[model samples]
Target chain A: MAPKYVLHYWPSIPGRGEYIRLAFEATGTAYTESNEPKTLLKHVMSCSKVGHPPHFAPPVLEIQLEAARSTKSRKTETSEDVKSSSPFFLSQTPAILAYLAPHLGLDGVKKGKNEEDPEVDQIRRAQVNQITLTILDLNSEVHDSHHPVASSAYYEEQVPEAKKRAEDLRKVRLPKFLKLFEETIASNEDEDHLYGSSLTTADLALFQLIDGIQFAFPKRAAALEKSGKYAKVFALKQAVAKLPKIKAYLESERRLPYSDGIFRHYPELDGED
Target chain B: MAPKYVLHYWPSIPGRGEYIRLAFEATGTAYTESNEPKTLLKHVMSCSKVGHPPHFAPPVLEIQLEAARSTKSRKTETSEDVKSSSPFFLSQTPAILAYLAPHLGLDGVKKGKNEEDPEVDQIRRAQVNQITLTILDLNSEVHDSHHPVASSAYYEEQVPEAKKRAEDLRKVRLPKFLKLFEETIASNEDEDHLYGSSLTTADLALFQLIDGIQFAFPKRAAALEKSGKYAKVFALKQAVAKLPKIKAYLESERRLPYSDGIFRHYPELDGED
Candidate 1:
């Protein structure tokens, strides 16, 4: 049976697709990931559906409304309903996450009297997105540490520059970003989440970011973890890992390993504290 | 009287904040930008308000609800209303833009009977955000062309790596992104906008992205423009610039010049196509 949600990305490494995957896995939602290169290429290279524009890159989400399945028996369905029920494609990791977060119940809900207020909902959504964007920004910087010259070029080709970039990332950037997350987590009343008193897409994104950093920069990540300053952040990572569904997914075959993806384990790039 | 929107960013140079400024200018909205370094630093460096978290970087938007002004006369106002009317600080350029776009009427409106459908609204918002994010991704790459190793380091410190990065950007990445935008614009029924049949924050974002690219890489930008391949994109840029308020703002003192910001013009970095 075709799932309601389909994810099209590179077949091999997790890359940015993992952020989307984590959201689904955490929520125990059923989603289909296109692991076949040919099928994936066709969907990503062009507009697979009418009314959808071409995607610039991978990690695209195609959402088919459930009502479309029952449309065969319903004679009252209008053209507008048919168009609305058609498969909708969206790209950009953050954009996909934001769209899915609310549906997945990861975009924290407002409490009490403000529950019905759109302004409160908007503020909550923006806060979650801002934190997710910051995590991704650091994730981009991590990728650059190894491929500083050009992402197209191999790390071996840019070793000298990579060394400089990785050194700065370890000595300056990583700590700065980690501290910001630490402060942010401390600010929230709930110690386990990045936003409100709940697990949000931002928390899932942060978990993946720290997991990638650990894979890419073990020595630096270890030192920072040992420092105890980012206790809240590490706690959140542990909390996310311990989620029943997320744990099952991580140990399952669906979770791809890090290789030549954005978060790469290059020994020379890792530095001691 | 204070404007409803307060923009906090660096005092000089048209950086990411310019994207937000263009949205306001194009809509003729009243906004105050904090030009003093100290005032701006205070808002960005710490949580200026009790409920807000510390911003990771600049381009933070402080939105004060209008109901707060009439609170003195409204004796029946509840505490929930007071809290909702408090100033909300949001960071992240795309987040700020997404939050402001709908209010500015740049998120695009549905013209048909499906207008009331929340799913339709969500899809439209995601499309606008996805395009805006893609443009910003290209913009980030342009910034990296000059400061390939580290954003904190001076461009002079990484000139060797900058050359290689800029070469890839000018010859490969820039053209690839431009082609995608061109295809997207052509895909739309309205040739002037990137998404629907109207001006959106995505269009405003694309205009600023191209404007900064032209300023930073004159040779490559001019070659691409003269190639006439991306006719729709350039036409869109021209359309955005010719907006009555945008034209006036561009000529006003409020619009800062490009300097040592994200899009820097190092003659050595700008290469021939």
Candidate 2:
């Protein structure tokens, strides 16, 4: 049997963990999420295995190797296989996505007979990561729009600062980032994809980012969408949404609703553009 | 001749470019900075070459291949070599560092005869990236401490919001991140490095992050340092500082001073712990 992919993250609110989920969903990869609060707390708070380092926070991806299968079929398995099959746990959303990209065929690199250029493949991977990181940076800024004063504090506590931040985000930062993404997509040879001809994880991330922004600031997002200034970005989002696996995943219950997470819908915060 | 590494960023402030510089300095790698404002603006604002995507911002790393040498030594080089040697430009600080890590021998992966395990090396690289991204996240938060309201606005405009953010940073986020780093260092087999036995780019990043925090919040950083709670983190900083290349780089004219960059010494923001 193949190795198991287990995701450890918060149970609710499609937070940073959503980026990892999109990668899995888009590729039709099988994975289990350990969202049980108590169990996840134990797994997240402690380094249960020897080789695994302590993760600062979750959306931790644990790749359980042969040991996971051997434990079920213990009588038939050899001790050597189990001994060598220690699980690998990796944290941080971008790191996790990058690790999974090539495996899921979402890295936009041609393989097999067509894989003539290793240099191009390497550059493509870097470009994918670059776009993903920039999208996440914008996501972080969106989160800060609500919790400007402190992440630890409630949004209500910093309403004034939140207004200021949301205003700047909608007015200045959002336009700047959106324009960049728009130009990036427009510049690419393939109109649908962010980097190469095929879909990459960067496109998936951008899809989720734009989706979240729309959810958080409906009026502003709608106005921008209607204006058609970022038609390429919106088109990419639509293209990603139209992917069979992604479409099914988004429609299913597995796709958690955005709530008190990074992208929250606060009426007052969603001011005029 | 080796390909030249040219960095494009703002000339005055260390900013995000500093992280890229530290990687080069720590490894004693030969690189040039295209800090001339006009030249840098052109390189940064436009995708001057084909195959290179437009960078959203700078601290762009341009690897001028055979053409850089051929331009000067046209009499010695073949047309084919120059034609194939297009410059590769990569942006995003963490992305740039990750790309440079393996080349600089700061990726914490063993090579040659001793490199028996490809899996371990891959895992080490992921761990190094995970740590580096986390430290950069903290660095971003440090930047937010003073510019809580908006990155575009002046600090004076958001002084009140800055105080709230800084207080939370000093009281909550700093301790949380510092403790995590402390525990990470303690958990590792090697006392000096974050992963494995040798230096990695993550350690260099952490050293810069801590140094910037000290610059931004002297009283708070001093108190924390004096308390010795994160002895290992500070010790790692000292260890990185004492590295001959890093030592020379720090004392040399190349090490730009902190001013209005991510970290700034706003006296009011550095409140009591």
Candidate number achieving the greatest TM-score relative to the actual structure: 1
Docking class of 2: acceptable
In candidate 1, residue B58 scores what lDDT? 84
| Cα lDDT of model 2 by residue, B120-181, tens digit | 45666777898899899999999999899888889999998899899999999999898878
lDDT (C-alpha) at residue B101 in model 2: 85
The residue ranges of model 1 lying beyond 4 angstroms of the native Cα positions read A1-3, A48-51, A66-77, A80-85, A111-113, B1-3, B48-51, B66-85, B111-113
Q: Please, what are the lDDT tens digits per residue for candidate 1 over residues B1-273?
A: 333898888988899999999999999899888768887777664653445566888898888765543454245456666675467788999888887877888886565644545575777788899899999999899989988888888888889989999999998899889988988888776887998887899999999999999999999899999999999999999999998899999999999999999888889888676
Task: Report iRMS values in order.
Answer: 2.6, 3.5
Task: List DockQ, one per candidate, in order.
Answer: 0.55, 0.44
User: Tens digit of lDDT per residue, candidate 1, span A186-259?
Assistant: 87778778888888999999999999999999998999999998899999999999999999999999999999
TM-score for chain A in each prediction: 0.91, 0.91
